[model samples]
Target: MGHDKLLVLTDQVAVSLATIWEAIKVVRKEGFEKLDPLIITQASSDCLLFEEPSSTDDIICVCKSFEFPGDKLLANIYGVLKPGGTILVYLASEPPKGQTMQSPLERKLLLSGFLDVQTSESSQSLAIVGKKPSWNIGSSFSIKKSTPVLPKVNFDDDMDLIDEDSLLTEEDLKKPQLPLGDCEVDRTRKACKNCTCGRAEEEEKVLKLGLTVDQLDNPQSACGNCGLGDAFRCSTCPYKGLPTFKLGEKVTLTGSFLAADI
Candidate 1:
Protein backbone atom coordinates (compact mmCIF):
# COMPACT_ATOMS: atom_id res chain seq x y z
CA MET A 1 0.00 0.00 0.00
CA GLY A 2 2.86 2.36 0.75
CA HIS A 3 4.21 2.01 -2.81
CA ASP A 4 0.82 3.01 -4.30
CA LYS A 5 -0.40 6.58 -4.75
CA LEU A 6 -3.48 7.87 -2.93
CA LEU A 7 -6.56 9.76 -4.14
CA VAL A 8 -9.67 11.12 -2.49
CA LEU A 9 -13.18 11.58 -3.85
CA THR A 10 -15.63 13.59 -1.86
CA ASP A 11 -18.28 16.31 -2.17
CA GLN A 12 -18.11 17.54 1.45
CA VAL A 13 -14.47 18.52 1.56
CA ALA A 14 -15.05 20.75 4.56
CA VAL A 15 -16.20 17.79 6.64
CA SER A 16 -13.47 15.34 5.53
CA LEU A 17 -10.51 17.68 5.02
CA ALA A 18 -9.19 16.97 8.52
CA THR A 19 -9.22 13.19 7.96
CA ILE A 20 -7.48 13.65 4.61
CA TRP A 21 -4.88 15.88 6.21
CA GLU A 22 -4.01 13.16 8.73
CA ALA A 23 -3.84 10.56 5.94
CA ILE A 24 -1.32 12.71 4.04
CA LYS A 25 0.75 13.07 7.16
CA VAL A 26 0.80 9.31 7.65
CA VAL A 27 1.80 8.78 4.03
CA ARG A 28 4.64 11.29 4.39
CA LYS A 29 5.82 9.69 7.64
CA GLU A 30 5.94 6.34 5.82
CA GLY A 31 8.65 7.86 3.52
CA PHE A 32 6.49 8.42 0.40
CA GLU A 33 8.02 11.72 -0.87
CA LYS A 34 5.36 12.11 -3.60
CA LEU A 35 2.52 12.54 -1.10
CA ASP A 36 0.46 14.93 -3.22
CA PRO A 37 -2.87 13.14 -3.66
CA LEU A 38 -5.37 13.69 -6.45
CA ILE A 39 -8.36 15.23 -4.68
CA ILE A 40 -11.65 15.23 -6.59
CA THR A 41 -14.38 17.33 -4.97
CA GLN A 42 -16.85 17.24 -7.82
CA ALA A 43 -17.82 15.45 -10.99
CA SER A 44 -20.35 15.74 -13.78
CA SER A 45 -22.82 13.21 -15.13
CA ASP A 46 -20.86 12.76 -18.34
CA CYS A 47 -17.42 13.11 -16.79
CA LEU A 48 -15.78 11.84 -13.58
CA LEU A 49 -12.62 12.86 -11.73
CA PHE A 50 -10.52 10.26 -13.48
CA GLU A 51 -10.63 10.13 -17.26
CA GLU A 52 -8.14 7.26 -17.65
CA PRO A 53 -7.56 3.88 -16.11
CA SER A 54 -6.51 3.30 -12.52
CA SER A 55 -3.13 4.88 -11.77
CA THR A 56 -3.51 5.32 -8.01
CA ASP A 57 -2.90 2.58 -5.45
CA ASP A 58 -5.68 3.66 -3.14
CA ILE A 59 -8.84 5.75 -3.41
CA ILE A 60 -10.87 6.98 -0.45
CA CYS A 61 -14.50 8.00 -1.00
CA VAL A 62 -16.20 9.99 1.76
CA CYS A 63 -19.98 9.79 1.36
CA LYS A 64 -21.32 9.96 4.91
CA SER A 65 -23.10 13.30 4.48
CA PHE A 66 -24.11 13.11 0.84
CA GLU A 67 -26.53 11.04 -1.22
CA PHE A 68 -25.36 9.34 -4.39
CA PRO A 69 -26.02 6.28 -6.49
CA GLY A 70 -23.91 3.55 -4.89
CA ASP A 71 -23.42 1.41 -7.96
CA LYS A 72 -22.43 4.29 -10.21
CA LEU A 73 -19.98 5.67 -7.65
CA LEU A 74 -18.44 2.24 -7.15
CA ALA A 75 -18.14 1.82 -10.90
CA ASN A 76 -16.25 5.06 -11.22
CA ILE A 77 -14.03 4.24 -8.28
CA TYR A 78 -13.22 0.77 -9.62
CA GLY A 79 -12.20 2.26 -12.95
CA VAL A 80 -9.58 4.48 -11.36
CA LEU A 81 -8.03 1.99 -8.92
CA LYS A 82 -4.89 0.11 -9.90
CA PRO A 83 -4.95 -3.65 -9.94
CA GLY A 84 -4.78 -4.90 -6.35
CA GLY A 85 -5.41 -1.34 -5.14
CA THR A 86 -7.67 -0.55 -2.20
CA ILE A 87 -10.91 1.45 -1.97
CA LEU A 88 -12.32 2.67 1.31
CA VAL A 89 -15.78 4.23 1.58
CA TYR A 90 -16.76 6.07 4.74
CA LEU A 91 -20.52 6.49 5.20
CA ALA A 92 -23.10 7.03 7.91
CA SER A 93 -24.76 3.83 9.07
CA GLU A 94 -26.38 3.64 12.49
CA PRO A 95 -28.59 0.56 12.65
CA PRO A 96 -29.90 1.50 16.10
CA LYS A 97 -31.45 4.57 14.47
CA GLY A 98 -32.89 2.34 11.73
CA GLN A 99 -30.27 3.28 9.13
CA THR A 100 -28.16 0.42 7.74
CA MET A 101 -26.34 0.12 4.41
CA GLN A 102 -23.38 -2.16 5.09
CA SER A 103 -24.88 -5.17 3.32
CA PRO A 104 -25.72 -3.22 0.18
CA LEU A 105 -22.34 -1.50 0.18
CA GLU A 106 -20.46 -4.77 0.40
CA ARG A 107 -22.54 -6.29 -2.40
CA LYS A 108 -21.91 -3.33 -4.71
CA LEU A 109 -18.17 -3.42 -4.13
CA LEU A 110 -17.90 -7.12 -4.96
CA LEU A 111 -19.94 -6.75 -8.14
CA SER A 112 -17.90 -3.79 -9.29
CA GLY A 113 -14.74 -5.85 -9.82
CA PHE A 114 -13.41 -5.33 -6.33
CA LEU A 115 -12.36 -8.33 -4.34
CA ASP A 116 -12.16 -8.93 -0.57
CA VAL A 117 -15.16 -6.71 0.15
CA GLN A 118 -15.69 -6.07 3.86
CA THR A 119 -17.51 -3.65 6.12
CA SER A 120 -16.75 -2.36 9.63
CA GLU A 121 -18.73 -0.25 12.09
CA SER A 122 -17.53 2.72 14.12
CA SER A 123 -19.17 5.30 16.36
CA GLN A 124 -21.45 6.88 13.71
CA SER A 125 -19.89 5.70 10.51
CA LEU A 126 -19.47 2.51 8.44
CA ALA A 127 -16.30 1.73 6.56
CA ILE A 128 -16.44 -0.34 3.36
CA VAL A 129 -13.21 -1.76 2.06
CA GLY A 130 -12.46 -3.70 -1.12
CA LYS A 131 -9.42 -4.55 -3.17
CA LYS A 132 -9.11 -4.65 -6.95
CA PRO A 133 -7.88 -8.15 -7.85
CA SER A 134 -4.24 -8.26 -8.86
CA TRP A 135 -5.20 -9.97 -12.12
CA ASN A 136 -5.26 -7.96 -15.36
CA ILE A 137 -7.59 -5.12 -14.36
CA GLY A 138 -8.58 -4.36 -17.94
CA SER A 139 -9.81 -7.88 -18.63
CA SER A 140 -11.57 -8.20 -15.28
CA PHE A 141 -13.19 -4.77 -15.28
CA SER A 142 -14.13 -2.82 -18.38
CA ILE A 143 -15.11 0.47 -16.75
CA LYS A 144 -16.63 1.82 -19.95
CA LYS A 145 -19.16 -1.02 -20.09
CA SER A 146 -19.08 -2.21 -16.47
CA THR A 147 -22.46 -3.35 -15.16
CA PRO A 148 -23.58 -5.06 -11.95
CA VAL A 149 -25.00 -8.53 -12.16
CA LEU A 150 -28.61 -8.56 -11.02
CA PRO A 151 -29.71 -11.33 -8.71
CA LYS A 152 -31.61 -14.11 -10.47
CA VAL A 153 -35.09 -14.97 -9.23
CA ASN A 154 -36.45 -18.51 -9.07
CA PHE A 155 -40.22 -18.90 -9.47
CA ASP A 156 -42.20 -22.15 -9.33
CA ASP A 157 -45.15 -20.88 -11.40
CA ASP A 158 -45.63 -22.14 -14.95
CA MET A 159 -44.79 -19.58 -17.66
CA ASP A 160 -47.72 -20.72 -19.86
CA LEU A 161 -50.26 -19.88 -17.10
CA ILE A 162 -49.57 -16.14 -17.41
CA ASP A 163 -52.55 -14.05 -18.55
CA GLU A 164 -52.38 -11.90 -21.69
CA ASP A 165 -55.84 -10.20 -21.72
CA SER A 166 -54.49 -7.28 -19.65
CA LEU A 167 -51.89 -6.62 -22.35
CA LEU A 168 -52.53 -3.87 -24.92
CA THR A 169 -52.50 -4.70 -28.59
CA GLU A 170 -50.78 -2.74 -31.35
CA GLU A 171 -54.02 -1.03 -32.43
CA ASP A 172 -54.77 0.00 -28.87
CA LEU A 173 -51.31 1.56 -28.60
CA LYS A 174 -51.74 3.45 -31.92
CA LYS A 175 -54.92 5.08 -30.58
CA PRO A 176 -54.47 8.00 -28.20
CA GLN A 177 -55.65 7.61 -24.59
CA LEU A 178 -56.04 9.89 -21.57
CA PRO A 179 -53.83 10.09 -18.50
CA LEU A 180 -54.30 7.85 -15.50
CA GLY A 181 -55.70 9.04 -12.20
CA ASP A 182 -53.54 9.62 -9.13
CA CYS A 183 -52.69 5.98 -8.43
CA GLU A 184 -49.53 4.80 -6.69
CA VAL A 185 -48.64 2.48 -9.53
CA ASP A 186 -45.24 1.72 -11.01
CA ARG A 187 -45.62 2.63 -14.68
CA THR A 188 -42.53 0.69 -15.70
CA ARG A 189 -44.25 -2.66 -15.10
CA LYS A 190 -45.77 -4.36 -18.13
CA ALA A 191 -49.21 -4.35 -16.48
CA CYS A 192 -49.14 -0.59 -15.93
CA LYS A 193 -47.84 0.26 -19.43
CA ASN A 194 -50.63 -1.83 -20.95
CA CYS A 195 -53.40 0.07 -19.19
CA THR A 196 -55.76 1.73 -21.71
CA CYS A 197 -59.18 2.33 -20.13
CA GLY A 198 -58.01 5.75 -18.89
CA ARG A 199 -57.64 8.80 -21.13
CA ALA A 200 -54.27 8.46 -22.91
CA GLU A 201 -54.35 11.88 -24.51
CA GLU A 202 -54.42 13.52 -21.07
CA GLU A 203 -51.33 11.62 -20.05
CA GLU A 204 -49.62 12.61 -23.31
CA LYS A 205 -50.48 16.22 -22.58
CA VAL A 206 -48.92 16.04 -19.12
CA LEU A 207 -45.80 14.29 -20.40
CA LYS A 208 -45.45 16.79 -23.23
CA LEU A 209 -45.59 19.69 -20.78
CA GLY A 210 -42.27 18.64 -19.28
CA LEU A 211 -40.73 17.41 -22.52
CA THR A 212 -40.15 19.13 -25.84
CA VAL A 213 -43.49 19.80 -27.55
CA ASP A 214 -42.38 21.89 -30.49
CA GLN A 215 -40.87 24.89 -28.67
CA LEU A 216 -43.69 25.27 -26.15
CA ASP A 217 -41.78 23.99 -23.09
CA ASN A 218 -38.58 25.65 -21.97
CA PRO A 219 -36.38 23.76 -19.53
CA GLN A 220 -34.26 26.78 -18.61
CA SER A 221 -37.10 28.92 -17.22
CA ALA A 222 -39.47 28.68 -14.24
CA CYS A 223 -43.19 29.40 -14.13
CA GLY A 224 -44.07 33.00 -13.23
CA ASN A 225 -47.07 31.96 -11.13
CA CYS A 226 -45.64 29.04 -9.13
CA GLY A 227 -41.91 29.56 -9.53
CA LEU A 228 -41.57 25.84 -10.32
CA GLY A 229 -40.21 24.48 -13.55
CA ASP A 230 -42.49 22.63 -15.95
CA ALA A 231 -40.85 19.37 -14.93
CA PHE A 232 -42.55 19.56 -11.51
CA ARG A 233 -45.99 20.70 -12.69
CA CYS A 234 -48.78 19.84 -15.07
CA SER A 235 -49.73 23.46 -15.66
CA THR A 236 -48.09 26.89 -15.72
CA CYS A 237 -51.00 28.29 -13.70
CA PRO A 238 -52.96 26.60 -10.86
CA TYR A 239 -55.99 28.88 -10.62
CA LYS A 240 -58.67 26.35 -11.50
CA GLY A 241 -62.05 27.18 -13.14
CA LEU A 242 -60.68 30.37 -14.69
CA PRO A 243 -61.12 30.67 -18.42
CA THR A 244 -57.76 30.15 -20.09
CA PHE A 245 -56.45 33.00 -22.18
CA LYS A 246 -54.51 32.54 -25.38
CA LEU A 247 -51.79 34.74 -26.75
CA GLY A 248 -53.16 37.86 -28.57
CA GLU A 249 -56.62 37.23 -26.99
CA LYS A 250 -58.18 40.29 -25.31
CA VAL A 251 -60.72 40.62 -22.50
CA THR A 252 -62.43 43.66 -21.01
CA LEU A 253 -61.00 44.57 -17.59
CA THR A 254 -64.36 46.12 -16.50
CA GLY A 255 -65.99 42.71 -16.00
CA SER A 256 -68.20 41.98 -12.95
CA PHE A 257 -65.47 39.69 -11.53
CA LEU A 258 -63.26 42.75 -11.01
CA ALA A 259 -66.05 45.13 -9.77
CA ALA A 260 -65.15 46.71 -6.38
CA ASP A 261 -67.44 45.62 -3.49
CA ILE A 262 -69.30 48.72 -2.20
Candidate 2:
Protein backbone atom coordinates (compact mmCIF):
# COMPACT_ATOMS: atom_id res chain seq x y z
CA MET A 1 0.00 0.00 0.00
CA GLY A 2 3.03 2.30 0.32
CA HIS A 3 3.70 1.96 -3.37
CA ASP A 4 2.68 4.52 -5.98
CA LYS A 5 2.52 1.85 -8.65
CA LEU A 6 2.24 -1.91 -8.03
CA LEU A 7 3.24 -4.51 -10.57
CA VAL A 8 1.15 -7.69 -10.54
CA LEU A 9 2.55 -10.84 -12.13
CA THR A 10 0.42 -13.86 -12.93
CA ASP A 11 0.11 -16.62 -15.49
CA GLN A 12 -3.40 -15.50 -16.46
CA VAL A 13 -4.38 -11.96 -15.61
CA ALA A 14 -8.08 -12.61 -16.14
CA VAL A 15 -8.10 -15.61 -13.82
CA SER A 16 -6.10 -13.87 -11.08
CA LEU A 17 -8.34 -10.80 -11.29
CA ALA A 18 -11.32 -13.04 -10.66
CA THR A 19 -9.66 -14.73 -7.69
CA ILE A 20 -8.49 -11.53 -6.00
CA TRP A 21 -11.65 -9.58 -6.76
CA GLU A 22 -12.68 -9.40 -3.13
CA ALA A 23 -9.20 -8.30 -2.05
CA ILE A 24 -9.22 -5.57 -4.70
CA LYS A 25 -12.58 -4.39 -3.43
CA VAL A 26 -11.24 -4.28 0.12
CA VAL A 27 -8.25 -2.25 -1.00
CA ARG A 28 -10.52 0.20 -2.81
CA LYS A 29 -12.78 0.43 0.25
CA GLU A 30 -9.76 1.43 2.32
CA GLY A 31 -9.48 4.75 0.36
CA PHE A 32 -6.58 3.81 -1.92
CA GLU A 33 -7.88 5.33 -5.14
CA LYS A 34 -4.81 5.93 -7.31
CA LEU A 35 -3.70 2.31 -7.86
CA ASP A 36 -2.72 2.10 -11.53
CA PRO A 37 -1.40 -1.43 -11.28
CA LEU A 38 0.53 -2.91 -14.21
CA ILE A 39 -0.25 -6.58 -14.84
CA ILE A 40 2.29 -8.87 -16.55
CA THR A 41 2.36 -12.57 -17.42
CA GLN A 42 5.74 -12.80 -19.19
CA ALA A 43 9.39 -12.09 -18.34
CA SER A 44 9.81 -10.25 -21.67
CA SER A 45 7.68 -7.45 -20.23
CA ASP A 46 10.60 -6.56 -17.91
CA CYS A 47 11.95 -4.50 -20.81
CA LEU A 48 9.32 -1.94 -19.83
CA LEU A 49 11.64 -0.90 -16.98
CA PHE A 50 14.24 0.45 -19.48
CA GLU A 51 17.15 -1.53 -17.86
CA GLU A 52 16.59 0.05 -14.42
CA PRO A 53 17.59 -2.47 -11.71
CA SER A 54 15.43 -1.07 -8.95
CA SER A 55 12.61 1.03 -10.36
CA THR A 56 9.53 -0.46 -8.78
CA ASP A 57 8.40 -0.06 -5.17
CA ASP A 58 6.22 -3.15 -4.92
CA ILE A 59 5.67 -6.33 -6.95
CA ILE A 60 2.75 -8.66 -6.19
CA CYS A 61 2.92 -12.02 -7.95
CA VAL A 62 -0.07 -14.35 -7.99
CA CYS A 63 1.10 -17.93 -8.53
CA LYS A 64 -1.81 -19.86 -7.13
CA SER A 65 -2.64 -21.24 -10.60
CA PHE A 66 0.59 -20.34 -12.36
CA GLU A 67 2.22 -22.95 -14.58
CA PHE A 68 5.68 -21.32 -14.88
CA PRO A 69 8.75 -21.82 -12.65
CA GLY A 70 7.99 -19.69 -9.59
CA ASP A 71 11.61 -19.49 -8.47
CA LYS A 72 12.71 -17.87 -11.71
CA LEU A 73 9.90 -15.34 -11.51
CA LEU A 74 10.71 -14.53 -7.91
CA ALA A 75 14.39 -14.01 -8.70
CA ASN A 76 13.47 -11.71 -11.56
CA ILE A 77 11.17 -9.69 -9.32
CA TYR A 78 13.88 -9.43 -6.67
CA GLY A 79 16.30 -7.96 -9.20
CA VAL A 80 13.86 -5.22 -10.27
CA LEU A 81 12.81 -4.21 -6.76
CA LYS A 82 14.16 -1.02 -5.12
CA PRO A 83 15.82 -1.04 -1.71
CA GLY A 84 13.08 -1.54 0.92
CA GLY A 85 10.63 -2.57 -1.81
CA THR A 86 7.92 -5.08 -1.03
CA ILE A 87 7.30 -8.49 -2.67
CA LEU A 88 3.98 -10.15 -2.08
CA VAL A 89 3.34 -13.65 -3.43
CA TYR A 90 0.05 -15.45 -3.65
CA LEU A 91 0.45 -19.24 -3.55
CA ALA A 92 -2.00 -22.08 -3.52
CA SER A 93 -2.93 -23.43 -0.09
CA GLU A 94 -2.16 -26.91 -1.46
CA PRO A 95 0.65 -27.69 -3.86
CA PRO A 96 -0.08 -28.94 -7.35
CA LYS A 97 0.59 -32.64 -8.01
CA GLY A 98 4.35 -33.50 -8.01
CA GLN A 99 5.46 -30.05 -6.79
CA THR A 100 8.32 -29.99 -4.19
CA MET A 101 7.58 -26.46 -2.95
CA GLN A 102 5.12 -27.68 -0.32
CA SER A 103 6.70 -25.56 2.39
CA PRO A 104 5.33 -22.16 3.34
CA LEU A 105 6.37 -19.42 0.87
CA GLU A 106 7.49 -17.24 3.80
CA ARG A 107 10.52 -19.50 4.47
CA LYS A 108 11.70 -19.32 0.87
CA LEU A 109 11.45 -15.51 0.81
CA LEU A 110 13.40 -15.10 4.06
CA LEU A 111 16.32 -17.24 2.81
CA SER A 112 16.30 -15.35 -0.50
CA GLY A 113 17.48 -12.14 1.28
CA PHE A 114 14.05 -10.72 2.03
CA LEU A 115 13.34 -9.39 5.55
CA ASP A 116 10.31 -9.56 7.80
CA VAL A 117 8.57 -12.22 5.71
CA GLN A 118 5.02 -12.94 6.82
CA THR A 119 2.28 -15.30 5.70
CA SER A 120 -1.51 -15.22 5.90
CA GLU A 121 -4.16 -17.48 4.41
CA SER A 122 -7.59 -16.83 3.01
CA SER A 123 -10.33 -19.44 2.54
CA GLN A 124 -8.88 -20.33 -0.89
CA SER A 125 -5.24 -19.17 -0.96
CA LEU A 126 -2.04 -18.31 0.92
CA ALA A 127 -0.36 -14.88 0.78
CA ILE A 128 3.31 -14.31 1.59
CA VAL A 129 4.88 -10.87 1.81
CA GLY A 130 8.48 -9.69 2.37
CA LYS A 131 10.63 -6.57 2.01
CA LYS A 132 14.01 -6.05 0.36
CA PRO A 133 16.68 -4.97 2.86
CA SER A 134 18.00 -1.42 2.64
CA TRP A 135 21.57 -2.63 3.16
CA ASN A 136 23.60 -5.25 1.26
CA ILE A 137 22.91 -8.76 2.57
CA GLY A 138 26.47 -9.43 3.83
CA SER A 139 27.61 -5.81 4.19
CA SER A 140 27.60 -5.91 8.01
CA PHE A 141 29.30 -9.33 8.33
CA SER A 142 32.99 -10.25 7.99
CA ILE A 143 35.07 -13.31 8.91
CA LYS A 144 38.75 -12.91 9.94
CA LYS A 145 40.97 -15.89 9.08
CA SER A 146 43.39 -15.57 11.97
CA THR A 147 44.54 -17.89 14.75
CA PRO A 148 42.93 -17.34 18.19
CA VAL A 149 45.08 -15.86 21.00
CA LEU A 150 44.96 -17.80 24.27
CA PRO A 151 45.94 -16.31 27.65
CA LYS A 152 49.41 -17.26 28.97
CA VAL A 153 48.90 -19.46 32.06
CA ASN A 154 51.39 -19.58 34.98
CA PHE A 155 51.14 -22.48 37.53
CA ASP A 156 52.61 -22.29 41.09
CA ASP A 157 53.66 -25.53 42.86
CA ASP A 158 52.65 -24.12 46.28
CA MET A 159 49.14 -23.05 45.08
CA ASP A 160 47.32 -25.77 47.12
CA LEU A 161 49.76 -25.75 50.08
CA ILE A 162 48.25 -25.39 53.63
CA ASP A 163 50.85 -23.94 56.09
CA GLU A 164 50.15 -25.33 59.59
CA ASP A 165 52.71 -22.83 61.10
CA SER A 166 50.63 -19.89 59.76
CA LEU A 167 47.38 -21.24 61.31
CA LEU A 168 45.30 -18.89 63.53
CA THR A 169 46.75 -18.36 67.04
CA GLU A 170 44.68 -19.11 70.22
CA GLU A 171 44.30 -15.33 70.91
CA ASP A 172 43.15 -14.71 67.34
CA LEU A 173 40.70 -17.65 67.52
CA LYS A 174 39.30 -16.29 70.84
CA LYS A 175 37.88 -13.27 68.94
CA PRO A 176 34.06 -13.26 69.16
CA GLN A 177 32.39 -14.82 66.07
CA LEU A 178 29.67 -12.56 64.54
CA PRO A 179 26.04 -13.68 64.97
CA LEU A 180 24.07 -14.79 61.82
CA GLY A 181 20.72 -16.42 61.09
CA ASP A 182 17.87 -14.42 59.58
CA CYS A 183 18.87 -12.37 56.51
CA GLU A 184 16.72 -9.45 57.80
CA VAL A 185 18.85 -9.22 60.98
CA ASP A 186 22.66 -9.07 61.52
CA ARG A 187 23.68 -6.87 58.56
CA THR A 188 27.44 -7.46 59.12
CA ARG A 189 30.00 -6.34 56.50
CA LYS A 190 31.98 -9.62 56.94
CA ALA A 191 30.74 -13.23 56.82
CA CYS A 192 29.20 -14.91 59.93
CA LYS A 193 30.66 -18.42 60.41
CA ASN A 194 27.37 -19.83 61.78
CA CYS A 195 24.69 -18.82 59.18
CA THR A 196 27.19 -17.88 56.38
CA CYS A 197 25.42 -14.52 55.91
CA GLY A 198 27.55 -12.27 53.68
CA ARG A 199 27.89 -10.87 50.14
CA ALA A 200 30.59 -13.48 49.31
CA GLU A 201 28.39 -16.39 50.46
CA GLU A 202 25.37 -15.10 48.50
CA GLU A 203 27.50 -14.70 45.34
CA GLU A 204 29.04 -18.16 45.84
CA LYS A 205 25.61 -19.73 46.33
CA VAL A 206 24.30 -18.05 43.17
CA LEU A 207 27.29 -19.16 41.08
CA LYS A 208 27.08 -22.72 42.46
CA LEU A 209 23.43 -22.81 41.48
CA GLY A 210 24.44 -21.65 37.91
CA LEU A 211 22.43 -18.42 38.09
CA THR A 212 23.10 -15.33 36.00
CA VAL A 213 23.38 -11.81 37.42
CA ASP A 214 19.80 -11.02 36.35
CA GLN A 215 18.58 -14.39 37.64
CA LEU A 216 20.06 -13.73 41.09
CA ASP A 217 16.58 -12.58 42.06
CA ASN A 218 14.41 -14.13 39.29
CA PRO A 219 14.81 -17.48 37.47
CA GLN A 220 14.33 -18.16 33.73
CA SER A 221 11.30 -20.45 34.15
CA ALA A 222 9.53 -17.39 35.56
CA CYS A 223 8.95 -14.13 33.68
CA GLY A 224 11.59 -11.49 34.40
CA ASN A 225 9.13 -8.62 33.99
CA CYS A 226 5.96 -9.87 35.73
CA GLY A 227 7.57 -12.80 37.66
CA LEU A 228 5.04 -15.33 36.38
CA GLY A 229 5.95 -19.00 35.80
CA ASP A 230 4.84 -21.62 33.23
CA ALA A 231 1.36 -21.53 34.75
CA PHE A 232 0.90 -18.16 33.00
CA ARG A 233 3.17 -16.99 30.19
CA CYS A 234 3.52 -13.20 29.82
CA SER A 235 1.24 -11.84 27.10
CA THR A 236 4.23 -10.26 25.35
CA CYS A 237 6.35 -13.41 24.95
CA PRO A 238 6.31 -15.46 21.70
CA TYR A 239 7.71 -18.58 23.44
CA LYS A 240 5.48 -21.35 22.18
CA GLY A 241 7.48 -24.65 22.31
CA LEU A 242 7.55 -24.99 18.49
CA PRO A 243 10.70 -25.76 16.49
CA THR A 244 12.67 -22.95 14.86
CA PHE A 245 12.39 -22.36 11.13
CA LYS A 246 14.65 -23.86 8.47
CA LEU A 247 14.36 -22.58 4.89
CA GLY A 248 12.16 -24.68 2.60
CA GLU A 249 11.26 -27.06 5.43
CA LYS A 250 7.83 -28.61 5.08
CA VAL A 251 5.35 -27.50 7.78
CA THR A 252 1.65 -27.78 8.49
CA LEU A 253 -0.30 -25.05 10.26
CA THR A 254 -2.96 -25.95 12.81
CA GLY A 255 -6.04 -24.06 14.06
CA SER A 256 -7.67 -21.66 11.60
CA PHE A 257 -4.89 -21.82 9.00
CA LEU A 258 -5.14 -25.62 9.02
CA ALA A 259 -8.81 -25.45 8.15
CA ALA A 260 -8.05 -23.02 5.30
CA ASP A 261 -5.24 -25.30 4.03
CA ILE A 262 -7.64 -28.26 4.07
* Whole-model Cα lDDT of every candidate shown, in order: 0.58, 0.57
Candidate 1 TM-score, C-alpha based: 0.43
Evaluate model 2: give its lDDT: 0.57
lDDT of 2 at 55: 76
Residue 207 lDDT, candidate 1, scale 0-100 = 56
Tell how far residue 203 is off in model 2, in angstroms. 66
User: For model 2, how big is the CA root-mean-square deviation?
Assistant: 30.6
Which regions of candidate 1 fall more than 4 Å away from where they truly are? Answer: 1-3, 21-34, 42-47, 65-69, 92-96, 137-262
* lDDT of candidate 2 over 142-184, digit per residue (tens): 6889999999998898789789867978887686866565443
Top-scoring candidate (TM-score): 1
Clashing pairs in 1: 177-199, 177-200, 177-201, 178-199, 178-200, 178-201, 179-199, 179-203
Weakest ten-residue segment in model 1 by summed lDDT:
212-221
Off by over 4 Å in 2: 1-3, 16-31, 42-51, 65-69, 92-104, 136-262
